[model samples]
Target: MASLPNRKIAAAVVREDAAHRQRLLDRAFALAFKGLVYAQIWEDPVVDMEALAIAPGHRVATIASGGCNVFSYLTDDPAEIVAVDLNTAHVALNNLKRVAILHLPDYAHFRRFFADADDAANIADYRTFVAPHLDETSRRYWEGRDLVGRRRINGFARGLYKRGLLGGFIGLAHLVARLHRIDLGEFLAAKTVEEQRAIFDSKFAPFFDRKLIRWITDQRSSLFGLGIPPAQYDALADGKPMADVLRARLEKLACDFPLDDNYFAWQAFGRGYGKGVAAPLPPYLQEVNYAAVKARAERVTMLHANMTDMLAASDAASFDRYVFLDAQDWMSDAQLAALWAEVTRTARAGARVLFRTAAEPSLLPGRLPDALLDRWEYRAEESRDYTRRDRSAIYGGVHLYTLKAD
Candidate 1:
């Protein structure tokens, strides 16, 4: 498949002998993201809220993945949020969420439309309240039929969580587990973390040791559903058996957080949020934050462009908070430098930037130029603290960088 225009930015960042491999990976990632890959953003917003310390005066710029975090940030009442993404699908999803927040009848309707998405009434709500308000691109995206002859919006009526690439990936995992006579769905039945750990140790943990499972995981293509690129896979696979690394990560996901309140766990294990379990809802989907998000929906501006391009065109000191969301892992030294140059140029006084890494250490020090990197203070201790507290335990590290005082 041809790579999308927005993905060219990711392609341009590769300056290594592995550029050919990287381009192929980027193409796969682009195709994966061309549809709804993330039913929900994987990054934990609670850690973001703490690290960014968003105030009413903050103007934020972030990469819009599934737009879950973008909407979550709205509850903080930031001055403005510029949500940029190269993928048109992500841009459309972000716009759809923003419009739904503004036009949806109530919090209950909102939750039904997105969270408990298997109800037929969600399609009705989309047409009645959200469809007319959608831009032409988003309207077409939602209304268009997919390979199965069902309109994309119909996924809401038929379980939206089970439609996207990530959803398909989870389904594949379930199929494989079944082949091993292990049912991952059983993980959802645990009433406490102890049971969760017990289920994982006995059932899930043994699957990773299977020769078939290990062989399948060793293929880099098998992870396209997770949105990991070739370079990222290399970073993740560094000096470790891929299956073992994955087993440990899944263990963290299964055991580290209380399953009752970890939506990521629910999505991974049960394939959807369990019925009537409202506590695990994403911040934007939670009732207490709904009205605040709706009121501030207009504060967000969605842009279909590369983050580097978007920041390069902006005025100096324009944004106060930057959320990179693991994008830097794909960058080369030159690309990282160019991005930080723009970040440093456009960042307001005391501006803060946060990003995640596939590896444990921050990527900036050796890769980015010192003149650019020196101006920012790395919040090493705070970042370690936040990473531990992050309920979404997929990432290796979460980092925070603050512009030094003038």
Candidate 2:
């Protein structure tokens, strides 16, 4: 996997002044992402689309974590979308989604395969329809077995959404909540924001009050399942108690959006999109955009490489939009500068870049060179607007920047 370098880079970010402490933190992050991290992306596609304002003439380069947003971007009808990731598992998964979208007979089967993911028939569908069409790398990944001895593809038949690193983390959260006599799933019955808040205050808020739960959350390794590196944990948990931050985020997840349309809430509370609830499905799975995504599936290209390397090899002014997806939080000052240098070189006029942060402010000012950072104008007002509307409710900030005209 090309992730070793990323792991190394991540490891190096922890200051060595602390000696043993920093090294231990580095190892944890390196080991955490050795396998599949996110079964689905956590970013809100609606907010991303609004921020990027993608047009048919634009070419986009985005990190392909779980690949949901890559397909969602297709709805905007961009000229090209290049999905890149250092994690080979994620790269393979993106390829699988692209191929599945292209090869699935219709929207119904696609929904069955992904949204209603636990049906055993999906195994047959995969073998009969999706598997043969997948590239060798993706085929090998899906066909491969985990520590439990089931092939990864069987996860679809068993509940694809509940199988990855994030899935396991949510499962743990559920178990802990159950131990406290709280049924997290009950939050899904909320019809209005008030009802949602009431349910959360009555049932969910108490889960965080437990000392055991707070201790577990305090540990950085506990968040590895969410693909959060140690550096990100430091940023997220800075001055506040980790449990408090998590409680606030979970509160937002449960109470800020209507349960009817927020698939993220469905995933968090109901585990698997409530079996047949198609209305809350991700944008790609939704019926209205299904045909359009299928038609444009071929336009996506999945690459197994770091974003910096990918951008370095590309033609100058080749791309119009970039989606960093909280990756900047994992980088060092030097690494951030190198990345923005390439981004500045490769971006076309009016190019837009979007990213999320574990912290409230953008990381560019102190970390990136002033000259490089000055080349783009930060859309602070728009970022704040979109951040409020982001249904995922996980990130601290959502940011957008556009290139300054020469």
Candidate 3:
């Protein structure tokens, strides 16, 4: 049987009394999610920061996945940040990042641990500095052995980004590309968008037409590594072949942004971030923003709980910003209403909510109650623009809603 937190994950992901095949996929997703999913979150914080316009003193509530955006948001210096998640591994990862940021001697050590993430010294550093300062839960998780019997902290020494489910998925993708005699790393060498498009056209786009690729992508379980639960998988597919959707997303990832600035492209193509101090990185990992993020690390409080439950227990009109991060796409109609009701109740005046969707349109119009929907203004035009600007290219929509002034 799954543990309590795993059961909570199942409650969120598994629909009740579905067809046998659907139930299997849902259960498989829940089981896969029991371990680390994302080593680095896929959403673009640069786009998020622009959409939210996070000003100083705002209190932000968000789902803490890989802790990338959580720390990046600290650059804006929010008064308080409440990060909630159901995944125990994610909660542990987030807490570990918090303590590491708090106690690591300098930016170099921090960068080496996260950015490089392939040095044996990192395990030593974790024991010497980060582990002692980490909370008991997080410490135990890091020291604990994974299913393969390697300590979780050893991930840092063995290339952390290449170890999670997402990492394994990417590794498989690279393997597939290799079997086709295509090197994904070639995309990273392109200095211009035209070059990227050319490489993608010649190497990647046609690969989707292969029979094995089509068959594999058609199965919803195949995407579990990307953290696409069954519900979101249906939305992402939208009755179209999954290969087409994936190809389109990969096109955007390859050609829509300069490789020099998009670390997401680096991660996808090079299997990790680009080399050296000058490489593109998340804001929290960048040297220029290091001090600000490190200083504000204490402002964040990570919890292993459902977002709605956490909000329900809080005082009304308390939160200023909300970031859902595609989690809402996993919700049913009733769950959507329940979450939005709590969101509306807890939001302060002029509060903003930002979330990504697997589909191009916002999921709220037909799903959320009119009364609750009437109290917020959806920034459709801005959302569309932000969606295009999102360098990650994995999401189809980036919706923003602002609470109407009382």
Candidate 4:
């Protein structure tokens, strides 16, 4: 697509010699379930639910990730939702939630399916419980016959969680921890915030912030293990001391938000959070939304496409809100303009768009046409509050804007 000058922004040069678009399922299937990714039902507090909380009749579209936010958004009574992602492992994880949330009968079973997900019962649970409701691809993904983990939702059972690039990162982390004479198991067990902080600030802080440790991890090759593309690393390195910026971000993660509620922080520090062998749960799991997730599960419809492309296929001005997440960082300027054109085309009047980025801004003024940016109102204060409140602490900042319905 010989698009536009804005396309320059989309041309994010990645430093990936090893990882390319592989067949998504097999890649995910083969990647052993190592517990690096969150697999629970908690929603991220960074997403401004109030922005997305349109009238019950409105529709929504968002990146599904592990499916936590999908279910969480459903609580707002959107007429329908389409959650999309490019990662197959992420898709499979969402499929797993689809079956469990919509059909598993009750929250207790739900709890076991996710909270105690590593339990022995999950094998039969997959075959007899969640398997049938899954789509053909998803159904094939869970059947015990070909799975690596005959029991561990097969994701955990097959060691698939341990095998992916992210899993390898966890393994590397464990090795580094061992070398330091630190037990991750002990850190995860810390019952008090003081205990967690004490260990993190003293033991983990040096690991992330020191020059030597920083030098190694900041390299293009080292980050590939975590599935970070060269482009992402380049974006991270944008005219700044990359490691210093990241260290500051991690420190914010440790100090800016409460540990108990910020599960994404757990992913970086402890590897996983929530119950049941650490499924990729979201922040909403902390309380009342548990039942809400169960009840709202049926309302969601999932898809496989780019966020803007998928929405482009829909009726214009149909969706009341948009959750682009961090995908825009992968986009060039023209792609963003094209995507926003779709967003502006299909987004209802007064619709809100929420997203995150490695850098700390709305990202439109530089890349997007002035007229379009003019129509939206950036809730700078709200963005500041939500971004600061982001318990994940992993991202740099959260940005919010309201598209003028007029």
Scored by lDDT, the top model is: 3
Give the clash total for candidate 2. Answer: 0
Q: What tens-digit string does per-residue lDDT give for candidate 3 at 1-406?
A: 7799989999999988788888888998999999999999999999999998888989999999998999999999899999999999999999988998989999999999999898999998998999888889888888999998998899899899998899999999999899999999888889888998899999899999999999999988889989999889999999999999999999999989999999999999988888887799999999999899889999999999999999999999899999999999988889999999999999998999999999999999989999999999999999999999999999999999999987
The alpha-carbon RMSD values of the candidates against the true structure, listed in the order shown, are: 1.8, 1.9, 0.9, 6.0
Cα lDDT of model 1 by residue, 201-280, tens digit: 99989888889888988987778788777677777787788899899889989999998779889899888876784548
Give the clashing pairs for model 3.
none
| Candidate 2 lDDT over residue span 243-333, tens digit each | 9999999888888888887899988887777655445877888889999999999999998778898999999999999999998898878
In order, candidate lDDTs are 0.86, 0.86, 0.93, 0.63
Q: Which structure is stronger by lDDT: 1 or 4?
A: 1
lDDT (Cα, 0-100) at 43 in candidate 3:
98
- Residues 274-379, model 4: lDDT tens digits: 4443344553453456676666676787764557668778887788788877767666677788888888888787888888777776677788988778788888
> Top TM-score: which candidate number?
3
Clashing pairs in 2: none
